[model samples]
Target chain A: MDIIVSQLMTGLSIASILMLVALGLAVIYGVTGVINLAHGEFVMLGAYAAWALQTEFGMGLLASLVPIFIIMAAVGWLVEVLVISRLYDRLLDTILATWGIGVMAQQAVRLAAGGELRYVQMPEPLSKSVTILGATDSAYRLFILFVALALFAVTWVIYRHTNFGLKLRAITQNRAVASSYGINASRIYRLTFAYGAGLAGLAGALVSPLKSVSPEMGTNYVVDAFMVVVLGGTQSLMGTLASSGILGELSGYLAFYSNDTIAKALVLLAIVVLIRFRPQGLFTARVRT
Target chain B: MSGKTKTEIVICAAVCLAILLVPVFMNDSFLLNKYARYLVLGMLAIALSLSWGYAGILNLGQATTFGLGSYCMAMALKLKTIPIHTGPDGLPDFMVWNNVPELPWFWKPFYSTTFGVTAGIVIPLLFAALLGWFMFRGRVTGVYAAITTLAAMVVVQLVIIDQQAYTGGFNGITDLAQFDVAGFAFDAYGSASYYLVAICLTASLFLALAVTKSKAGLIVQAIRDQEDRVRFFGYDVALYKIFIFSVSGAIAGLAGMLYTIVMEFASPTFMGVPLSLSVVIWVAVGGRQSLVGAMLGALIVAGMQGALSESETFLDSWTLVMGLLFVLVVLFLPKGIAGAVETITARFERRDPAPAQQPQRTDAAGAGTHHLESLP
Candidate 1:
């Protein structure tokens, strides 16, 4: 019973992090119709940003989150204006270009930070453990779960109720019709891309303390996040949440039974098999073209 | 033949001839050895072009086949190495260290040189065929195929790393004996090895070129241009995709075995992400649609890498430079170096009236005829 409770907690924690990462990817890919392979690099850059802020200025990870998000958003904006903006509608070309950007970001970090692993300090107050459902777990893990839920709720409200999101949705449905309605599709795209990138950055910042920060860390995260978004079905926010929960629990349970490596391999194989059956993914909304 | 086809054939012939004659002019064993590795990589680029350029399937896990081939060859060679490197029972050293008392059934077949050679090509071919069957049958195209392949590669890599006893784990298979056939040996630094690589590359180029010119090849190109239309015309699109993917995998496997022979060892990194991405970069730089151009791209980019790594500062920044080049190529040189050459040649040929025989059958015309659909 203890093990089950603890496992459930760990699974939820993992699911929250996966949701955070996949959320940004879903938004970017869903709205823009561009697959940003550099999404992981954005997450990586966020982790680095957190490390720099803490090491250089003694800022706490929690306090540095907003600044890191904004900084990453600006960086994303620049990438959009410079590269992704030009390659719109060219899906394959966009993938290659983003991969190039990812490589450059990784190499640039290696050159700047010297390719060594960096660490981020957890907040002093969140260092304790808490018992939930008769299971003791890290307070920090619970904190991440809280933050993730809060962010998702915030995103849901923005997506469903905000005028900006309405314009973004209009653009997504029909760019020509949306443009005719006086919606600046390009501007919305830029902002949406930036916002999605910023969310990825926040996930990175949150995850930095749990994992060692490195230039190559983004590759793994990107792959995982992609699996989540892909499994959830692109453009489906609710599906991203559900799939992340399913995969997170699946990986957590599998890892508990076997080892981390086997668990990861199994999860990937399962996703591949699932994708083979349903290329549209597990939860695609029914709509007429 | 169209003017473009003529130009491609002439260029391919010149490149093959130049590769064969290099030993005649260059006696430096060190450079000759380096060129041999590049030529083997050139074979890998050709394989990638067949699938990505011709069939329009971007296989991001190409290194999976290459690494599998390398390991197969390495296992066989390891068995033939000096007894000192083996266990008391003559098993590979890593197996002994892991307390594996007997040679596993899988590793046993690799003991025979002929089996190793055949398995190197056949295994990857089968693996790719199985994967391609699932993918194409499921109608997975474009970016989805790329992601699935990438995920599969990572899964394979993780499994290899996890299985320390059979795979040699992270250290990989090393201390292999020289590649030998009966009494004849091909030393790494000798002309024999270089000649073998050169001959294989030339043969592969011809084979690839021949395939590109065949009836099925034309159909494959047509499928790339308009997949649904080809299906409506009663062609089995999935079957052709599977064939090209398997053929490409077989070629990559062969390249991997050659890599193990030339580099003298096989590591898990052989099937790593970086090497796989590098192969794609070479194809992109060379012009993915042209087999000969793709091969040349591999040679040039790999040669540049060798040169860059020779210096400390440049070694660190080489990937950065490559990244920028890839981005620039996508932006301004989408068709790559070969595409540029064709444009220049077409301009010169424009002066002649009716320069081409088949108007609808040119490579560029096919490429320009269709814009790929972005799947939701």
Candidate 2:
């Protein structure tokens, strides 16, 4: 029983990270209608940026987050203006183009930082494990859960109440109609893309402490996030969150009993089956083409 | 044939001959070896083009099929290497270590090269057929199909990695012996292996071309362009899709056999997602929808990677360049290099006056009169 409780906590922590990553992917796909295969690369860049700041400048983990987020957000904006903007309205091309961008980013990082795994040092507070309900849990894992909740709240507020969010919703529903209403679709796309990318950057920062920081580390999470998006239904934040939690918990429990690889494969197979049965995903969006 | 088509055919033949003669002029055994690797890659690309270019099935799990083929060949080689019931536990060395008493029943037939080759093609095809039937029969298309195949790739990779006793885990299978065709010994590392690979590639290409020109190929292309319309016409869209997918899988398997022969090793990386994605890039860069374009694309990309990897200056940035090229090609040339070439040549020919137009028009009309002369 204690083991089950501890495993559930671990699952929640993983769900937190999955939610962060999948949220960014969902938002980007919602507004731009682009799958953004480089979304994982953005997370990777964020992790690397944080790693560089800590190793090179000796900055604290919290202090490194802000700068890394800004840098990654800027990169995202530049990518939107330069490459992604040209591939709009063509989903296949967008998928291919962003995949190329992903490869380029991954290879660039690989060239800079050989294929070795680098560790990130957590703060003293997060370094300790906390005892809860007769079970010990990593403080860092608990912290990630809190951070994820806070981030989710912040994203929800921004998406629902903010003017930018309003414009984004407008653009996503009908681009031509939104433009006719005098909303600059391109401006919204750029800002939302950067915002989504910033969230991915934040996700990378969050997961860096838990997992080894490496150029190809993002490869592990990319497919899972895509699965999350598909399972949740594209462009639905609620759906993303719901699916992430379900998958994270399912995979964690499976991993607890079985091997990690089998757990992952089972989750993937589940997603395929779910998509086959319910193409619109678990949570259907009201807006349609 | 008209003088223009006849000229095009002659030019294509000349190019093929030039490629064949590359080993004659290149004194370096290393260069010849590299070209041989490219030829094997070309076979895989040809398979990619048939399924993706013509059928619009963006199969990103092609490496899964390729790996299946290679593993079959490797298993046969492994079986040959082990002595018959000499070990402590009458089992293959790796299986014994993993605690299996005897060879897996499925792997038993792979002791024969002929059976191994057949299984290599048949297994992937059977898998693809089942998968295509489930997905396409239900009218799944576009991104859904892509995701399904991608998932299959992940599943296959995980399975391969976990079944370490049988598969050698991440280390994969190695030390495969030279293939014995009838009574002739074809060494894996020497010129004989290269020649074997070349012959396999050429034969695979010809078979792929033949399949692409068949009636079933036409139905597959029709399904690609208009699935609903094809269904309305009383055609079994799922059957056609499965057939083409199976053929493509077989070709990929054949390519895998050649790949193992040339590289003399097989591992999980050979069937990983990255290799699958690379096959997509090969088809795209070569000009999807054109067999010849796919062949050239694979040759050029694989050949360039080999050459560039050798140079210190190009090593670091080669992947970046390849990625950029992928993006550029997808954006600028949607039909790929072959389509671009045809478009360019047609434009140039349009600019020039036609000396013999009436006969060509008559021939075109006559060809059009046929319900289906050849598959696209």
Candidate 3:
């Protein structure tokens, strides 16, 4: 009973990370119809940002979150204006182009920061253990679980009631119609893209203490995030949230039963089968062809 | 052949001539060997172009087939070096290290050269056909196909790594002997290896050219450009996709075999996402729709990568340079380096534009990739 409860905690925590990574990707794909391959790099940059803040400037982890979000948001905006904006009409080219950006971002980080893995020191306050259901686990994992929930709630509020969200939804429904109604679709996209990027940064900041920070960290996250976005209908936030939960828990349970590598392979096989059956995604979005 | 096709062939012949003269001009055996290796990679680029550029199927897992081919050859070579092929306890050294008391079941057939050679090519082809059936049968095309291939690649790579006892795990199959065909031995260090690679490259190039320029090739291109229209015309779209995909896999497998011969080892790095992405970029940078362009693109890009990464000063920054180049090429030069070459040559020759630019430039299928998904 204790082991099962612990595994559930692990599954939920992993699910949170998956949802965090996919949040940005789902938003961008939903609004702009651009599958931004560089979404992973944005998360990577956020981790580096936290490392720099903690190591170089002596800022606390929570304190650096806002700055990292702002910096990464600006970077995301620049990417939109310079590269992604031009190739909006070409799906494959955007994929290739964004992939190029992803590579550049990775290399740029490597060249600037050096290739060695950097650690983000966990704050002293949360460095203790907590017990629940007769199981002992680190407080940091519980902290991460809370942060993930907070992020989801924050994202939901932003999408549900804000003017930016309204414009984003209008644009998604019909860009031309939205423009005629005096909503600048371009501005909405730029801001939304940046916002999405900021969410990725936030996720990175939250998860930095748990994993080693490196230039290639984004690549792994991006692959998982892509799977999550696809498995959930790409256009539906609720679907993204649910699918991430399903996959994260599935892998978590499988890993406990077997090994990590076998669990990963089985997950991939499951995803491939899933995509084959429902190419559009888990939930069908109502849209005009 | 048409004049444009003839020009493409002539340019490829010139590249072959340059490679052929390397041993004569440069006494450096290392450089000569590197050039041979690049030629083999160039074959891979052509295979990518055949499926991606010509058939409009972006098979991101092209490297998987190539790596499988390399493993096939490496397994055969590893078996030959052993004193015996049978007995449960007579395992390869690595398996012995892993405490396997017997030879694994899969490693048995590789003891025969014929089986190895045939299996190397056919396995990838069959694999592609099976994958294509799953993908195209479900009407998965474009970005969907790309994602599926990428996922499949990760799965295959993980499996290879996990089964370390049988596959030698991450170290992969190594310490291979010079490749032999029946009784004929091709020495790795000698000129025989170079000639072997050169001949295979030339044969593969011709084979690709023949396929792309044939009547069936035109239909395949048509399918890429106008899938719905072609389907309306009463053709099996999935059949065309599967055929081209399988052919591409065969070529990639052959390239893998040559890679094993030249490099004397096979590793999972060859089948991973990064290398696979580089192959796509090479084809895109070379001019995706042109075979000769794709081959030259791989050769040039790989050659530069080698020189840059090897030099002490640029070693750290070469990957950054490559990424920047990739982005710039994707954005401003969508037609690629080869496209520029083709345009310039066409202008110099001042050929009849009417014949060159036929009226069949169907505007519908020419969207850069896809303008947009349906709006909600």
Candidate 4:
């Protein structure tokens, strides 16, 4: 019972991280109709940025997040303006181009970090454990959970209540119509792309302390996040969050009993089966563009 | 052959001759060997172009099929030294480490080279056929097909990585021997290996071209351009997709077999997602609609990598350049290097017409539109 609860918590924490990763992917896919294969690479870049700041400036974890997010967001915007802009309507080209970008990013990281997995230093507060619901858990896990939830809340609030959010939603449904209504489609695209990438960066920063930081680490999570986005339906943030949580938990529970590789394969197989049945996704929206 | 086709054949022959003479001119065995490996890689890319460039099936799991071929060859090579009943000294190393009593049932048939080769091509083709039938029959196309294949790649890689006892885990099968054909021992190293790879690559290219020029090839292109229309014409789109997919898988397998011969080892890395993605890039860069373009793309990319890896200044940033090139090509040169070349040459020829008038220009424009409409 104790093991099961502990595993469940771990799963929830991992799911939270997965949600953060998939949210950005979902948003970009929703708005631009571009599957950013390099989306995971952005997360990787953010983690590397945080690591660099921590090492060079000796800054605390919290202090590093701001710079990391800003830098990654800037990079994202540059990518949008320079590369992804031309590939907006062409889905297959965007996939191939971003895949190339991903390879380059991963290799660049390898050159900088020497292909060795680096350990991120957790703050003293985050290194300890706490009791929750009659079960002891790592505080770092709880912190990750809180941060993810907070971000989710922030994203929800931004999307529902803000003008930018309304514009984004409108553009996502139909860019041509949105443009006709005097919303600058290109500007929204650039901002949304950067914002989505920034969220991925934030996800990386949140979990850097938990996992070993490596150049190739993004490849591991990207597929799972893709699965989450696809399973949850590409347009809905709520659907992405829910699906990420469920899939992450299922994967974690399976990993507890079986090997990690098998667990991952099972998750992918489940996603394929789900996709075979429901090509429109589980929680589809009526936004036909 | 028409004069144009004859000219093309001559140019292709000259290029093949130049490639064949590289080992003769180069003193370094490594350089020659690298060229040979590139040829095999080129074969894989050609396979990709046939399916993706011509047929519009973006199979992201090309590496999976390639790995199948490599493992097939590796298994056959392993069986020659090891006894059938007593597998590699009473137990294969991995199974021994995992404490398995007997060889798995699947490993038994791999003892025969014939069976191994057949299984290698058949398995991937069957897998692709089944997958393609399920997806294509249900009318999956474009991005959905790409995602499904990508999923298959991830699943296959995970499976290969997890089945450590049979697969050698991350440390893939090694110490493979040279292939023997009907009791004739063939050296699998140095010049001999290069020749073997060349032969396989040429044969595979010929086979691919034959398929591309056949009636089925025309139908495949028709399906690519208009699937619904093809279906309306009473063509079984699913069967054609599955057939082409199987052929592509077989070609990829053949490339894998040659790859093992040239590299002298096979690892999980050979079949990773990156390589699979790289194959797509190769086809795209070469010109998706042209077989020769696919080969050129693979040759150029692999050659660049070899050169860059040997250089001190640009060793790490090669992929960055390739990535930039990818984005640039997609943005500016959608038809790729070959397409760009064809466009330039056509313009030049148009300027120097042989007594042709305005009628030819209209015909040329009509041809161009036909080509454009055929493109996916």
Candidate 5:
């Protein structure tokens, strides 16, 4: 019972992180027809932001979130203005352009930070393993779970009930009509991109303690986030949530049964197989074209 | 053929010949060897262009085919170097270190040079054909193809790194014997290796050119321009996709084979995302529509990389420059360097202008004149 509970905790923790990282990708992809290949770099930039704050200002990871989120969001806004703004209509070209931006971000980080791992000090209160539901796990892991749930709730409310959410969804369905309705689609796109970047930044800041922060760290996470987005049916919020849960738990369970590497390989293989069969993914978004 | 395109063809042939004759002017074996590596990589770029530029398929995991091809040759070369003292049935060094008792049965076929060489090319085709079948049958076209291929790359790389005993794990299969063909030795330091690589690259370029210029090539281009329209015309889009993908994979594998000969080892890095993405960068920068341009792009990019990494000041910023170039090309020069050249030449010299969009249907397969018009 202890092992099963611990496994479930592990699964949920990973699922939460995946959800946090993937949420930004889902949001940006949903609002803007452009697929941001630089989404991973935003996550990386966020982690670096947290690291910079922790090391330079002696700030804790928990304290660094708001500032990091703002800064990364600003970066995202600038990126949209400078690069993504021009390439909105060209989907394939956006991939190439954003990918170029991603590479530039990676190289820029490496040039500034050097090719070495940088660690963030885990907070004193959450440093130790604690018992939850009669099973022991890191206290930090539980905090992340809380953050993920809180984030989901926050995002769900912002998009579902808010006027801004309505504007964003309206533009996504029909840009001209939304503009006809007097919605500033471009302005909304900038905010959506920035908010997505901020969310990614928060995911990075939260995740810094779990692993040593590095430039290349975002690459794997971004790919996983992309998988979530692709498998989640690009425009569906609920799909991202459910797919993240399934993929995370499946890999976590598989790891318990066998090795982590094999678990990862099998998960990828399964996703590929699933993608082959269901190209549109699990749930299709209803957009009025 | 227009006088300008004929000049472009002449320029391409001259560049290849000049690279082939590089040893005469340059005494540096290091320079010669580096050029050889560029040509090998250029072969890969050509292979990528055939599918990506012509068929409108962006196979983001091209390194998978390249790596598989290299590994096949590496296994054979590693087998040849296995000492008799380890016994006739003894495994490679890494396998022994990993406590693998004997040679794995699958590797036994790689013991023969003929079989190993054949398998090196054939396996990648089969792998690509199977992947293409799955992708095309599922209608995983456009960006979905890119996503699936990238995922496939990660999976393949992880598998290679995971199975230590079978694949030599992280370090990969190394210290390969010099590549030989029917007792003709290819010493890394010798002139023969360079010629062999150049010959293969030139042949592959022409072969791809032949393919793109054929009636089949027109059909593939039409499919790229309009998939459903061609499907409506009763062509099996899936079969053509698979065929082109397989051919591209075969050429990539052959390039990998040559790469092993020049580089002297094959590692999991060959199949990693960065190298695979690098192939896309090379093809895109050279103008994907032009085979010769793709080749030159690889050559130029590889050359710049070598120079930049060596210089102390530019070392850190070189990749940044590459990234910047990638973005700039996509935005400002979508047609790439070749497109620039074509336009520049067009302004200076006017001729019987070919249709601005698609080339006219040409029945002649080997007409060098037809080659220039069809390429852009």
Candidate 6:
């Protein structure tokens, strides 16, 4: 029972990070209908921002979160306006273009940061270990889990009850009809894209202390977040939350039995199998195509 | 033959001749070895073109097949080198280091040269067939196929990295012997290896061109243009996709085997994400629709990479330039360098239009229009 509790705690922490990353991807893909392969770069940029803020300005991770979010949001806005806006309906071209954008972002970071691994310092207070119900984990991990829940709650409220989300959903359902209804679909897309990017930035900033910061770190995050979004229905926010939890738990449990690399492989294989059977994903929402 | 096909054959012959004459003009063994590696990469570009261009299947995990072929060849070469490196145990050095007591059953078959050569192509072909079967049968198209294949490739990379005893972990298979047939040896720096790659590339290029021009090739193109419409015409769309995918896999495997001969070793990075994406970039830059153009794109881009890396500043900025080029190509030069050549040629031939090719332009434009609506 204690082991289960401890594993559950570990799973929750992993799920929280997955949730944060997938939230932005799910939002952008749901509204814009383009899978932003460069979304990973956005996360990487966020982590880099955190590292820079800490090293140069001596800012704590918590204090730099808002600034990193804004920075990444602006970056996302620029991407949407410059490249994604033009390739809106061209799905394959969008994938290629975004991948190019990702490569450029990675290479640019490598050049700027000199391709060496940079570490972020953990907040002193949150660095200690905490025991709850016979399960001990870093306080910083619990902090991450709490922040993820808070973000999800905020996302859920925005999506469910806000006017901006209504417009976004309306456009998602039928772009022509939404435009006819006087909704500025393009502007909504721009904002949503920015917001999603901001979420990914926050996730990256939070994760910087845990994982070593590098140009290629974003690739793994992007792949993991993609699996989460893919497994969770693409357009479903709640589905993203649920799928992350399931995947994180599965990964933690499998890694407990075997090793990290094999666990990852198995999770990917499982997702592929699931996609083979149900391409609509595990928790598909009823939306008009 | 049609005027277009005649032009293609002439171009292929010219390119092949130029490749064959590289060692003659550049006597430096180092340069010859590098050119040989580029030739293998050119073959990789052609393999990508077979599927991505003609079949409209953007296989993001193409390196999986290529890497599989490389490993198969590497394993065979490793066995031959084992007698010299390790004791009478006959195990790979890495295996012995990992405390593996006996030779794994899977490694035993690779000892025979015939099996190694055949397995290099067949294993990747079978793997691709299985993957293609699942994906196509499920009607997974466009980006879903790309993501699935990408995930599958990562899984393979992780597995290869994790199984340190069976497969070399991270460092990859090294210290391979020269690939030889009976008494004849194909040295990396020798004219024989360069000629071998040149011939293989030329043969594969012509064979690919022939496939693209055949009736089934036409049907494949039609499927790319309008998949559902072709299905309504009573064609098994999935079967065709699987066939082309597997064939592309086989070609990639052949290239991988050739890569081992030229590069002298195989590593996990051979099939990593970046190399796989680079293959796509080569096809995109060369002209996905043109086989010769894709091959040249690989050769040119790879050659430029080798040249540019000599300067420290250029090394840092090369990926940025390529990335920018890729983005710009996707936006404006959708047909790439080959497309530009076709455009110039078309203008010249406009005064005397070929009746046979009147609808080609319209067909491509129509396909573009269809693609926007069909993909979600």
Where does candidate 5 clash, by residue pair? none
Greater-TM-score candidate between 4 and 6: 6
lDDT, candidate 1, B108-212, per-residue tens: 887799999999999999989999998999888888888889888989999999998999889999888999999799999888899988888888888888888
Question: Model 5, A3-122: lDDT tens per residue?
Answer: 889889888888999999999999998778677888888988888998899889999888889999899899999998988888776677888898999999999999998879998888
Tens digit per residue, CA lDDT, model 4, B180-214: 77876655546766777777776777677778777
Query: What lDDT tens digits, residue by residue, belong to model 3 across residues B7-35?
Result: 76787788777766666676666776788
- Note the DockQ of each predicted structure: 0.79, 0.66, 0.82, 0.62, 0.77, 0.80
> Model 2 Cα displacement at B232 (Å)?
3.8
For candidate 3 chain B, the 10 contiguous residues with the lowest summed lDDT are B367-376
> Which segments of candidate 4 are over 4 A away from where they belong?
A111-114, A285-289, B1-11, B20-32, B83-91, B311-313, B354-376
- Model 6 lDDT per residue over B148-264, tens place: 899899999999999988888898988888899997999999989999999999998988999899988889998998899999999999999998899899999999999999999
Interface Cα root-mean-square deviation for all models:
1.1, 1.2, 0.9, 1.6, 1.1, 1.0
- Of the candidates shown, which would achieve the greatest DockQ relative to the real structure? 3
Q: Write the per-residue lDDT of candidate 6 for residues A1-289, one digit (tens) a residue.
A: 7899999988898999998899999999878878888888899999999999999999998899999999999999998898888888677888889999999999999999989999999999999999989888899999999999899999889888999878888998889999999999989999998999999889889999999989988888888998998899887888899999998999989999999999999999988887788777889956323
lDDT (CA) per prediction? 0.89, 0.81, 0.85, 0.81, 0.86, 0.90
Better of 2 and 6 by TM-score: 6
What local lDDT score does residue B365 receive in model 4, on the 0 to 100 scale? 86
For candidate 5 chain B, the 10 contiguous residues with the lowest summed lDDT are B357-366
Better structure of 3 and 5 per DockQ:
3
lDDT of 2 by residue, A68-89 (tens): 7788889999989988888785
DockQ (model 1, Cα): 0.79
CAPRI band of model 5? medium
Candidate order by TM-score, highest to lowest?
A: 6, 1, 3, 5, 4, 2
| Model 6: docking quality category | high
**Residue B160, model 6: Cα distance from true site in angstroms:** 1.5
